[model samples]
Target chain A: MLSEFRNPISFARRSTANRRTVALIAGLVATLALAGCHKKVKAAPPPPPPAPSAPAPTASITATPDTITVGQSTVLSWHTTDATSASIEGLGPVPTSGTRTVSPTESTDFNLTATGDGGTANATAHVTVNTAPAAPMAESNLTEQQFEENVKPVFFDFDSYSIRPDAQSVVAQDASFLNQHPNVNVVIGGYCDDRGSIEYNLALGENRANAAKQALVNAGVSPNRLRTVSYGKEKQFCTEENESCWQQNRRAQFTMDQ
Target chain B: MMNGKKQPLYLLLLVCFLLLVITPALRAQDWVHTGTNLGVQHIRVAVASFKPLNNNAQTLPLKSIFDQTLFNDLKNAGIFDMVSPSMIPPEMPGSPSEIHLNLWSAAPANAAMVVFGNIAANNGQITVQGFLFDAKNPTTPQILGKQYSDLANDEATRMIAHRFADEIISRLGGGINGICETHIYFVSNRTGHKEIWVMDYDGQDAHQITHLGDVALSPRVSPDNTRIAFSALGRDGWAIRMYSLTLHRLVYFRAPVGNSFSPAWTSDGTKLAFSASGPSGNNEIYTIGANGGDLHRITAFRGPDVSPVWNPKTNSQIAWVSGRTGLPQIYIMNSDGSGIQRMTDGGYAVSPSWSPSGQFLAFAWNRHYGPGVLGGQDIYVMDIASKRWIEVTHGAGNNDFPSWSPDTRHIVFQRDNQIWTMLSDGTDQQQLTHIGQNIMPNWSWK
Candidate 1:
């Protein structure tokens, strides 16, 4: 109804102005469309990416025995392929590459990590916490008692003839046992590793025996009750040339005189 | 009466001419050899000839010194009627096997014993091979023996010949064993320190036993030849230590802090008598069980008393060198350290060692008899009962520490850090060692 009421002349003038405005609008739309198309093409080139190069994360993580016995300690450390771990669980970064001792806790697995490059490398350490093996118990008045009680109590350095300080107590104890039983006689038998000449080892064995006897006498044992003999390298508890067996052979033993 | 006096003068002149004619044969045959002959009256000995063993043709040092020694060893044996090699005619056969038995049979020699030996050089070892023969029967030569000995390259081969001479004496049954196998134990200071060394009687095959490089003195062997007791210093200090010849062990008995030395083992090998200085520095003679038991104080004295020598047979008396009279002297006491009697009279005498036969005591004496130069210490032997001391060695060298041989016929002592020996009397002195400067030779009973 409103369009029928409009004049022809007004309609024509309005139509020309509308045509010019429409052409101007069309040009602006074309320019805006071209800019949008240019943006789409530029974004397609950027889709290939600058690669995943953010620096490979170093594997500075390591594993260690989780639990150490009471008398022994185990080392726990971290390993990294490229970078090192700053610290683990606030224990502080291991300045040098090695095993670190954690608090003697229950046996458990621990996760260790190294934070660097693109990621963190982690390793699990199984610690077996155990109590130290008890030293052999000492007793008196048996045939083999002295072997276990006195000799077993004494520990010697590897391939050394000199008696250790810790072995003094054993000698003194044996000395006291002999002194207490005045009728009982004792002999300090010195032994050595098979490392020197027979004559030299015999002399060394004698020295070891003498040293034990001196210690016994110093502990108030009568020199008469205690005699010394050197077996040299003739006798050995263990003949193998390993640290474990050598430690067992180099010892001065106390035996009741027959 | 005038004719009878003229006849007596002519007879005396004729007797003198006969004595001059027979003197050459007597002088030519110096050694008076004794042999057990049931059928023969004269037993002849012929020393075989041989060529030098090696091309090294070097004369040993001290030739005259050792030649005299060889002469003493053989001459003293009294078994050989030694015919001088020069006395044999040049036309006579040289080697024992080459001997013309008929010529020797017609000569003064009957049943001649010939010694032929070869001296060969093998590396540093010398092999002396010899065979004894009856020169009267040259075809039947007896192979006496063969011995190989290690000797220094520079030593003379003459000792080898002397050794063969000794073997010849043994084969003749002079009743004395040859000294080739005998060894001499002495202390040597060649390493700038004293060590015990054992060498063959001829001063060859020398070897050091104690590498301690410390002062080792007064070495005495056991009667059984199984042990050697001497004094050595180690980390434990100066004490008497015994080395078992069989076990080769060094055992030190528990002694007081002060030097416990001068150990002399009993003949039974069960006990040892030694001079001990307590921590208080009171030197006393003490007897201890061989295994370090039952230590008994033998002497109670304030002066330094040492050098104990046990009587092998008596076992009741100990003849020791003591310093009781403000100077070192020889003293004898009971086994329990009672009834002490001074054996040596005046001057300074020490190291009294009783002979194995228990008849004589050997000791060393030094006197201030000269104007300013003090008398040099020399070895002396004294009769135990008579207490008459006879000086055995007399010279400028300081001879001390007389150690009697197991047979009691020879005494070895120390002179200038070397071992020397002489007869029981002061005669036939000879140096036994030329290297390492040996002292304190202890003869083994075995």
Candidate 2:
């Protein structure tokens, strides 16, 4: 072992082998053997242990199917290197590497922090939560649907709130439907064609709605089950500037009300 | 690195050099005081951009808002021939010592009046020092100097600017009060419901006033500006409703016998005149106390009579629309429904709004209103004494519901689906709303 330590110095003197070169090689070998003897003598006292140093912890996270609808959920998978503990932002302490199912009501960012003796590392995974479209009424509850299908809207003539003969029959049918469904309350929305002044049209539309309600009251339907509101020419059902479109807009629409 | 270190010093030196060079030249120049008296002729005014006094994050933005609002208010004052910003000197004079009369009174600017100010913000508060100068006078150029301090916010900054502009207007535009501080209440369907909404007279900072998820129309603010009298559709059908602005909730207004529409507040704020149908199914003009009692029928006409408006100047007369003849026409009568006089000779006149001065009546008139008549509804201002009317809007998408400004110099009306304002002589027309269908704008009394 002592000769092994002196091989580097002897190789340097291989080209020149004079007395000085031989003397230098012998000196280096003697010094190396003495250092080896000194190391062996020191080994018994237990040499100081090397200082412990750790590198920074690495962390990475991913969310599978990051985008989900309102009722759906997403999975967040994470992995960490050289971390003693790890935790997500919303969730408490978890394993160093694991998967978690998260269902956030809104858009959220999940942050993961991994801590170790060396350092702390962070990784973030963004999950986009989209609000689902408004759910339709339940299949068993068909009050609104029945109102739309059975309670027909009665049309009016130009500048006239008087229910026409044809509109009379339609109003009668509507009243009959309301009488049949006594549990349902209905709001009669009076609308007008996009003509005339807003204030005047509001008054005219109210007159039409009241006339319709009066007809229903005359037909055995309780007046308490009916309410009237005038839309006037404000919210138009048809925007086309034509006679047919105006006729379609000038009507008393029936709607289910709470 | 060396240049960056000395840059501020260089800037200071340059500023010193400019002041030394400009101050003596300004002092030595001839100062001519051009006499432009108010009410005689339009004064030529120059509005310099407000100087930002500091580098705070809120300073520049607040200054910009103040600058724009003040400029627009002065431009819309209807009595000033405003100088173009390009013609005026680029230098903004923040104080009396900084203003140069020769620079403003000379060639390109040729302004008789100059308005300048400086704005600063620190520690959540803003300070504004505004000045109006007679640009012609060198020794005594200051016309009006005012200072305002308020919370550091866009709204407060805007209000400070408005107050400053009103002061300038009141000083320069004869004795008429500025309408900049007024509000315009109208109907907007922006929130998917026709709710009453209010905004500044120049149409800024619009917000909903009522959360009644139904149709509300004809918002007439009380003379005191404490409540709004309007008609809303509710469970009992169309009824006149009162909303207390200070209370931020609906107050009680007893419904008359039939459906009530178009509630018009008297200038005294004691009563509201409206039109409602009776048992005969014909709408008639009716008056009720502001506290919702003492309902009385003012008109017992045979045909439909609706849309009543009290003469604000003299609360003894009212102008309303009557269909007693073949078509609707504007009529003026006494408060007790006597002394009936037809204002329009022919052709569909409705929605009469008496001017604050009681000299003119602004109404929506379709002179050629007939089948295939080839004309649309337009707004007209009529001299009540001579019945001589001037058409304010021509062929602009069926304009209607013209409400006179409190100043009597401007009119707000609904054209198509948006609310608009223009001078009484049909100039400087501006579209106020762009979001949704807005209609029936009523100017505040104050």
Candidate 3:
């Protein structure tokens, strides 16, 4: 019945319209016929629900000053979002977001990594380091003989390796000279007067050298710059049997290590 | 019946006569035994120069060497009061029929015993006839008679003299063997390097043993006299090195880690106890096999432990020097590293050498050790059981490294860069080396 009513209205419309209006009425009647074929209409089922997802992790790191001189330190700041764990190269493990002070002896790149259930994120901060200037060539241009002369030998009492009061001042001066000439490494030779057992004197001579070396270290000289050896009574500065000669023989003499 | 009774009587008479003759012979063999101990009364002895039997060119020289060696040996015996050669009669007895015993028994020659010998050299061969007589017993004075034949040389003649002198010493000075045939091993730098050297007991025929251009110290000859164990500095630092005297080369010795010094041998010549800084970098006493295995650490305490010497008589105990109690002192312990005892109470004492008899320890000590101490270093010998010590060397240019002669009656040590020897009681101090600095003298075991 609806199709019959639509056909009559379309016929009445077509009789008063031109061919274009009649073609439009024919298309409208065909749409009505197609709509009338469905007896009942129902809403389409909603699309499958989207999967649950975790947010991606983010990481950022920055050094307060990316450039530094040798022996200088820099502060590194970093932040991470949705991160369960974070770590920086050379700094080991760290809090998710924090700052740290690092003193690198050389230029280095500090890399930060943030890890979470979602994935991993990486960030890096490059630090530029300039080496300290070389020690002055004039200070390092000392000949071995000159070095020995500048660093006078220290003496010890008979049968004792303890640094005498007079020798203490000499040791301090030696240490000061050594510190100034940073490139000069020295070998301390301990000697003894020709009195006592050879073996015992050897040991005593070693003690003397060690005592002098320790004094130098105490006076702020780097221990790595000094070495010790014991000549005992094998090599003597003087062969006389008197006290003056013996005093000369019993000493801790310094020489430049090649 | 009459013949059998007569035979029994004859047998009894013969037995009585044999006993009468044998008893006096046994009594004559008995000698007064004396030693280096205190309160020993020395026997007065006279040694006449050995008469040269032939006028061959080698005869006089060999005879002189023999005569001098004999006199020196008797003098160094420490059990004899030697009569001056000038006091003896001019008549040199070459045979029993030529001597006047009464002359020796009387006057300035007031000798209780007399030693005389005659030497002859013929065609590069030498013969010596030595005799010892009891001057007090004029009728039966012959106590010893020996004949020695060897090649005509100074060394052979001296050796013959040593044998004869040793015979007399054995009969009169107790049954101890003489050290005349022994050698003294020492370190000398005369060759521009501290090398091991050896010389006769009487400071004769000194020669270098090791040619190791490196520094070598403290040469201890094994008891067998076939090897010398010493400390030497090498590319790998100080290590205990072995030199074979028989093979004339450096033998294989497992170099233990660290600086090893002062290698001493046990009496059996199968092990050596030395001081080495092991992995701990502290000096400790360790023992290893002579052929190099079974390394065992004997000391575990702190401080430097060095100069180990075995009680040669037992080979079960060791005497060493340790700085554990501050300043080195003499210490003794079992070979198995137990029952440690400090032998020295105080002061600096080191280089302990055990006497062959195992009753005394000879060491170098500075009793008043410290800055400005009045006394210098001296050699001391202490009785192990009594702990009583006697200063053997006093104010003698820093004497040290005292080594005991095999006979236990003499000690050879270093004094003022020279090798010296003295009696155990500190008498007869004689310098053995004069050319170069010689130190750390060790007497051969034999």
Candidate 4:
């Protein structure tokens, strides 16, 4: 027993006071037990008391609005048990049961960690923030994509920015839509076919955009709410080198702010 | 007996003296001979991989880049029948002493001209020594030997190659500057929206110059290559915007609301002419001083008049597309909006680009622009003096907006949403950009 206590690894693990007590107990036991001297009797020491284990903390987190558009806020409510302290990564340290409101521009996951005597418990709540033309100007009835589809492009004649008679109805429809949605701003985009130089087509397209814009203003849409741009034969809808493709290209488009 | 021995020794000394005097004279006579290629023949050239002068971290990498760049530039010059490097003999010549011209001129190589150079990159500086040799001539092989140094980087090394190649072309190709150093500014939608991009004339070192992240079109680099003027779709509508190349920032040009497109730089770089939709009305040509103020309206018409370009040579005249006659046609006028004359007699003509020499205007015109025309539009070059037009590109694709090279020897135009360059005589058409839809290619003047 005394030889066993002298082992370096076991001696290192034992506290200095524990080591001394162990040595003294072993020496006394060995000395008394070996008095008969017929055969050496082994000293069997009792084991130390087991430590009490604390339970792991439990945590739960839920978001008030699990889904949101870009620039909208959501609240995360959390509750924890058996935890000394709790924290969220983005929100920093928080009380055991509290809520945090974050208006993340993008979709993000909020993780809550509750730490206690035993270990830490983690719970995550995700907010799905979608990216569209999102925001104050968006309508519940229509999305930005649907708005673009509703305002059809007005086509033009070859080498001309003058709006064709066929395209007037489309421009009027776009104007009516704008009248209903005064909060929304629209950019009128003019485009030309791949017929002329990019610079020339750009001017041509700008003229086309302005023509559509003039029609909208004539139909009572505010000029301040509308802007114009020319793609100048830069962006094309089709790649075919035919008249059919060219006809599809020459037009005035619209984009609305959400 | 002593006198006889002295006589023989004198004869030997005389022989040595005669050989030395005659060899240099013979070499000079052979070297000074004028060498010219046969009628309309390609100059069969060989570009040797650059020899590194020192062993440094940048030496090997820069040497390979310089060599490869020079080789590609020469090959793309379109006037050369390049002898493949693999077929040429393995001799990395840095100087005349190391070159054996016979190895280049012989057998499978058959190289008429050879370009060899040494390169070194050290202490953030690059030193390049390039030599062009007419190997067909035995005596005086060296035609041009130039040394160029600049801040060491991939761009500088490529510039060195461009400058050296230009020198070779100038000495050989009847004095036309190589387009190697020229830059092509175009609009690309690679990053999801139309933004300005600039690249080497041979479509290398392509990068976005504008991060507007919006639609920007018709990028026109200034004559001095300092700024790029383009139209951007901002909150207030399409406005002309200038980006300073030196400052690496956007410059405010105070363009009118929804009115600016197709910015053109005057020859002196003093003024910019652009067609603007004036007064929320029809398209008109306008000129503004480079420093912004002094806006001069050049034309006001019922129909759209656009794509104004200054006559680079005179700077006194301007050419643009005017639609007064219903269909757009090429029109040339004096700088102060005087001397207006129609350059194109009829048929849809737009995007008139004045030649650098001021002798001709290259534009996109479809003689039969009516529906069912096989070719929707093609590039046409009309001499400003005679007004005689020649079709530069036909069918293949709808080609338009032909901008001239500084030398007036080549024209770059946009076709099928891609950029292409061809000689002024309608030959050697080469497509420059491929990835994404590239349009509005404006070649830098220099």
Model 2 pairs in collision: none
What is candidate 1's lDDT per residue for B1-446, written digit by digit as tens?
Answer: 56776998898889999899887765454223221231443345654344344564332232233334444455443345655655443342324445455554455444366544445555655555556666555465554655535473434445665566666665675345555445677777889887777775546667877677666665777767677777775533357777777876676556553456668888888888887553223457788887888888888753456778888878789987654444456899999988899987555677777887888888877643211234467777878898865666776577777776554556777776677776566555678787656666766543
lDDT of each residue in A1-258, candidate 3, tens digit only? 323323543464456457658778999999898787653342454344242666778999999799887656899999988778899988899988889999888889999999977899999999988896444545556887778877999998766566788877798889888888877788888789976666656556666777788889989988898866666687789998778998999999998877
Q: Which stretches of candidate 3 lie over 4 Å from their true place?
A: A1-188, A209-228, A237-258, B1-41, B51-55, B87-114, B133-147, B212-215, B233-239, B254-259, B275-288, B291-306, B321-350, B365-370, B373-377, B393-398
For every prediction, compared with the true complex, DockQ reads 0.00, 0.09, 0.03, 0.17
Chain A in model 3: its TM-score? Answer: 0.55
Score each candidate by Cα lDDT.
0.61, 0.84, 0.84, 0.81
Error of 2 at B24 (Å): 66
- lDDT-sorted candidate list, best first: 2, 3, 4, 1
Tens-place lDDT per residue, model 2, A1-258, is 323433543463344347657878999999999999999987786344233677788999999898887767899999988788899998989988889898888999999999987899999999998896333533237567777988899888766676788887888888887776666788888889877787777767776777788888888889888877777786799999888998998888888877
In lDDT terms, how accurate is model 2? 0.84
- Pick the TM-score winner: 3
lDDT head-to-head 1 vs 4, winner: 4
Each candidate's root-mean-square deviation in Å? 39.2, 38.8, 29.9, 33.6
Specify the poorest-scoring 10-residue window by lDDT in model 4 chain A: A1-10
Leading candidate by lDDT: 2
Q: Clashes in model 3: which pairs?
A: none
Worst 10-residue lDDT window for candidate 4 chain B reads: B29-38
lDDT by residue (tens digit), candidate 3, B104-178:
989989999999878899999999999999999998999999999999998888888888888898888779888
